[model samples]
Target: MAKLWILLLLVCVFAGAQPPERSKAPKVWDEKALAEWATPIAGLNVRPSHIRPKEYYDLPVVSLRTYPVYAPGREPAGYWQRIQSTGPKPLMEKKGSRTATEWIEAGKIAFEEADFFHLRTLDPKYIAEVRNGSLAPSRVLPDGTLFGLRWVPTKQGVALSSSNCSFCHTLYLPDGARVPGAPFRTIAPRPPETFKVWPVFSRLQVELGVLVGSPPFLMPGLSVGARLSQGYGVPWKSDDPHERLKTVTQEEYEQLDLAARSSGGLPRWNGSIIFPAKTPDLIGIQERRYIDHTATHLHRNAGDLMRYAALVTSAEATRFGPHEMGGPDTKRIRARFSDDDLYALARYLYSLTPPANPNPFNESAAAGQRLFQREGCVNCHTPPLYTNNRLTLASGFAVPANAPASLEILPVSVGTDPSLALSTRKGTGYYKIPSLKGVWYRGRYLHDGSLASLEEMFDPSRLQDSHSPGGWRPLGTKTRAVKGHEFGLGLTPAERSQLIAFLRTL
Candidate 1:
């Protein structure tokens, strides 16, 4: 028995304790691969260009750790004083990342730690304003940290910065729990009026606008009208709406933006202010076949996700054919994450879990499930992951003979408005049929987020111009018809309720 016990001890000691080995990550910034990754836009038939791999990799890798911003009076004692004096600190080193679990943890740190805009506030007065509740990003974490803001200590001073992924992607529930990778509810961005007391932070906001709100502008020196002109126009296409931006003054541009920039939709780089895309929920991005609403890029693997992270952050070429948006003065300083950091971020994003469904799959949901099948929703939504994972053509686009065979294009358009699919810099003339796996948790509906609720989506009244949309609308739009996706509209009130109940349970 002593010998047997000794043998068992030896067996336990020698056996390995680790997860299954991870495959070597593919090289994400391959020029040849990037050239072929995106689907070309419809009318112009030109693919959005990307910067050379050298341009991407040459940027300095900054992996500084970010600190949480506490609401007024809620921060731990001495948190403010300690952080103010400290210099920037690196979040992690590659030497410590051996196992998948370790890499994922590092990735989470990288995700939460990286900051885009460094609003330098050298004086103690800036901190006082933050603590006094005069200035704070709206969404608050349960611990009282502002969800969208981070305090980043630099060599000069503590700067206010936006948290990397969590700023836009995190969803806060009524119970005070946070769901990472869920879509964020936007609080109206603070107008410049609030920034009068903090001049440094306000100036930084203008400089940072080149990276955040108006990233498509290659040069920061141009007037708002010129920047707008260069930022969003499809040069090759004669009918591009962005052409008008060249003639507008700064005040005119502001007026246009005031109306175009709605709550659910904000114009992104290569995205149109007139046809802004809604923020996507990143919870199940691993299961997706394409990226973006227009199926702009193929989601080939983790490498692709990493490449996307790089492209969005700093690598965009802004070169569609011969046109360079910023002209010759496009040079600027930009930050990058190491390839390993990006790989870990992709892995962490893939690992995001959907929250448990509070809606029980009882009789009502079951009946709705039957109705779902009877209405043939199964053809598109499917089961399990709840998406068919196919691309559907927009109303105006005709599939070209050269369309990649790899994409499962469902030739028929859903008859939805085709403006976003046809007009934007990112437009590819197709919209991926979205998955309904977490429909219950999604606060907005439609690619542009025109509807606020599932109930609002099913209401036939929404098709009329008199209907007041429950969600986002263009600036001047008080009432406008929300068209298309006419499915499930014919169902009775009780039937629609049942269907919604079943959808929530998903």
Candidate 2:
């Protein structure tokens, strides 16, 4: 009996000592693989011009101290200097061979650390001062850790401070709960004075001969400032150089101003042709077959998301490049980041889940769910993932006959604004039908963010030229009509309320 027990114990020990089964690693793509995988569902007939070789121009050597800066509630310069004296810690810690789960973990870190927008305009000292608590607690969560911004270590101690994808996507609730992959709701419109700062800086840069060009002029910044100022009910200065350099015509600006005031919110970008944009929630993005408001990029798989991340980050300079181009350009960048990094990032993004809804379905919400299907909302915002993952043509965009069927262009127009699909670099002559999941947490509805709430969307007064009694009015204009997506305007007040309740449950 003792010998038999001993034999069984030995067998157990040997089994435990053997290596555990390992999960398969996520697939990493090489350049060739990525190109083949991302082959446009439809071949693009309208190819952009070939990039010319970069010309080296002499840039002015300017002292950092000469720059005038302002951060509303920042600490004195000496405090920042003191912190900088201590070397910055590395943003990412080293890890071993990455499994699928490990890739997700690494991807989360990358999402927080990566700077895709190239918005490194602020002095590092200012960022440090503001982050260290001179500014409001808007960016900090209940845990006392920062949410969107981070101070990364550079070779010259800790000079780089950047905003990542989380800056716009992460939402901090009113009760101090922090939710990742949610659309930001607390962002207040920038004051007119705040908009004035960047133009001053850009003018200085041009005067110092630091930047010499026309197409790449700091127009994006200037446009944003003008849009913000107009949204804030501030008068536009006709003689302002920033206003004069704008791509948007005076009539377009007037329409934008009217739209902003009517919605009581900022207007989203009319493609790149206008200013501002609706910040999209990142939850459940993995299921999306297309990306961007205009559905410019058909997301066949995770690699597409990684390509986007690369284009937005350190590789942004290559967007309209003379040499290496990775994004929309024909040529690829000279130095490409490892496919593993993007794979990890995509895995992490795919892992994100929406926060659990505190509100459960009630009798009214159940009725609303039935209405949701009956009202034709289910056609575009389909069930399960809540999107058909197809593109709808803008009201006026004429689809080319040679356009490939793989592009999945729908014949119907939802009557939404067509400018974003017609005018911007991202315009594909179609607008992607957006998923309705998490619509409850989102605000300033529609592609342009022209409506502030779901209730406001059904308001009949929105279709009229004059402001409605209880409806939201744009900041500057008295008589502005909010048109498009007029599906549920006929719903009774109680039905609308119930529908909104059901939407929150999504």
Candidate 3:
């Protein structure tokens, strides 16, 4: 027995003596891959600007998950929910809408059912079972939604519409257009996709279907539509995944992608929304200075939430009331909603949070930070929250031109009253500044996503007279370029590289 024990011990000792193998830790970006990404966009100041002192915005912070999947109190709701909870108070009511208790009581009814997770699974039978004015929680069109694309439910008809919104607005890639004097054109191997964790380059292209290849402005999904149709319009011809991205003319591309601009000669297209953009991700939306493409401001408050819901979901187009965009189908939906239901949605929207992760504290990125301040990118995108949260005509884009001349007559932002502007082509002067929190996760960067990658944003060649055909293409493009954040016009390639490294750490 002693001899057998000795032999076993010797075997164990020999096994332990074998060298321990080292395991590789997962990297967000492989060093080489990150370098490649930064190479083309060299010299842009991507580091967070430190010129301003960090003044924390006291926005509400809430947990994102809820029990029973989407229960109101257990898991905090997102901005979409909070925006809808304002209920049916008149936008100009002196006394405001309802008591806190009253809202919650009614909100519970709305909250119980007016959730996407819940609605996505509802049986058609359940939808049919609800009687008008039922007031019962489960029976109250529990699956009602403003539109699949919106972050929070709104009274706007387009907000409730599906696929169309997502296709036009979210996940956009730049058309590769350039600013008046930029030096580089935005270039990328693929189209934009939502950013998750990374090995980034290859993984983004292969698995998540980040867009790859030409007509840089085209969204990958839309490219898919074009390839399938073989030059036809949306509702593409085929479902074959491989055959969906053939090159086509810009007009042809838009034809397949955008809703018709002028259907049978009316002012609007058959399927277009006033704002055809996709509802952005809400993970860090509380930090944005602005809310809509029009730059409609929504501070993190209950009153703004109420107005958003009532204006977007309510059936009537009464000045401040909801505007239905879904034809006859929407009229039926609006009839079913009440003020209390709106409150639930508002409650949900105000409760959003950025996705969780510890700050990377990348040392290499520190060099980039210095560059950011040196380059003056800090004026608009001030940090740690990363925005001044102020509105300016800079984002007005073409909206002012397209609007009636009366809008031009109004004093720019502060001088004009919002109420009057609400009724006219132009009214409000305030354009909310968006927060830069979580900018890394979004692609088709910028409010319009005109640029394909960050690289195109900084190239000086993009700013030349030959580049931008119609002034600066802020969203970015292929032919012209999206100028960099105007930081580091004098940066050397090596320093620019370090700066990009720091940006990735954010």
Candidate 4:
């Protein structure tokens, strides 16, 4: 056999002279090595390779990813701009140094004494003693006593680790004073005096209320309805076709279209819009690098809050809920946060910002901002801060051939609408590209609020195909189905009210 063909041509010339297999690849960690490994844990660090997760979640993700890209108001001429060019306290504070106005009045008196709702009590036997790990969700002291007198640290019932932003952004501390809650009304219920839950607007619910100072029409839907009630560990059986979904029966809507054409329907979240879904306002989320609302983890701060407090809390929070975090003061609220109060509540939520640019250039919003950049939409809406943040796929989404290798996916640019990621429960068509900057009071919009306004989002008969709860729906004649970034479609009705007067000045 020709000596086995001369030993297979000398093993194919020693595998093509050996030098070509050098691409062991895998190095992609840009932004100058993630700003030198996030400068000692992101205290104003920024370097996710100098912007582009839609400008690093609409700007300032740790001083623009760990400093040095100056320009827009440069930053050199000294004395911190001659002490902020003679300031009164807004060169990022320090004029009269009342020690940064006494840590902003001791963070508004520790956000009004940890928003004291009788210091924390949900009791329906604390959801079956957090599903039998045996009762524990502490922080009590207004007489009912408990602020660490102990219990809550279960391993598979829920709550063993918490940097405590009111155990997942639902704060109010009323008799204590912090206010903000809406997501499926955990209480505080009573605000609809014309409080539009939708009617149009969503560049990701106004970039998640400009990266988390959120208020005007709040969001975070009770921490995504406490992450779908701790990832559906109970509820569901109202007759089970995924919780008796409002009057089915056409043979259970043909067995929910054969269970959404087999295996990709119930990861869920729109629980009547997560019981009102609000409470997120972690005062500018560590200078907005990104977290949830599908913006996943692009350069997130606090090591993505210690990987969502070790995967959203103890005993691997049962792979994210349906029970875990032990009960009975789970070892005294894990000894009342001492990692310097979890880096001072992530440095008071990365020093929150947003109350400044209240409507800067309006000539009927500059003719609806030249018909919103002559309708090509400045290519994913670019500007000082309109949105180029990046993540596409809204048109007719269908990418899920079993996604989740920790979802590094992308690709959906051709006119986005994808019938609610092929009809919901997060059917992985990938999302995240958000940010527009407080579109004049954020309201119900996509990521499942469905659409509500911006003039029914340019009504081309609400994008046909018989609109059901499929996607865009929000405002009334009741069929919303519209999906991702479809910016002011085919205008004209005074250019959709001058692009809603240039999105009410962002």
Error of 4 at 324 (Å): 11
Stretches off by above 4 angstroms in model 2 are 1-97, 116-149, 187-275, 314-338, 467-479
| Residue 290 lDDT in candidate 4 | 44
Pairs of residues clashing in candidate 2: 116-312, 116-313, 261-473, 261-474, 261-475, 262-474, 271-420
108-218 in candidate 3: lDDT tens per residue? Answer: 434333322111212233222221212123201122321111122333211221121122222212443211111111222221211111122222223222222111111
Expressed as tens digits, the lDDT of each residue in 427-496 for candidate 2 is 5667788888887767657776666677777776788776442323333445567677887778988998
lDDT of 1 by residue, 7-56 (tens): 99888776755455654455678987786787787776767688788877
Which runs in model 1 stand beyond 4 Å of their true positions? 1-25, 95-97, 117-133, 136-141, 186-203, 207-218, 247-263
Query: Lowest summed-lDDT stretch of 10 residues in model 3?
Result: 262-271
lDDT by candidate, in order shown: 0.73, 0.52, 0.32, 0.34
| Model 2 C-alpha lDDT versus the unseen true structure | 0.52
Clashes of each: 1, 7, 83, 60
Residue 384 of model 4, lDDT score:
56
Please name the candidate that would achieve the greatest lDDT relative to the true structure.
1
Per-model TM values vs. the true structure: 0.89, 0.68, 0.41, 0.26
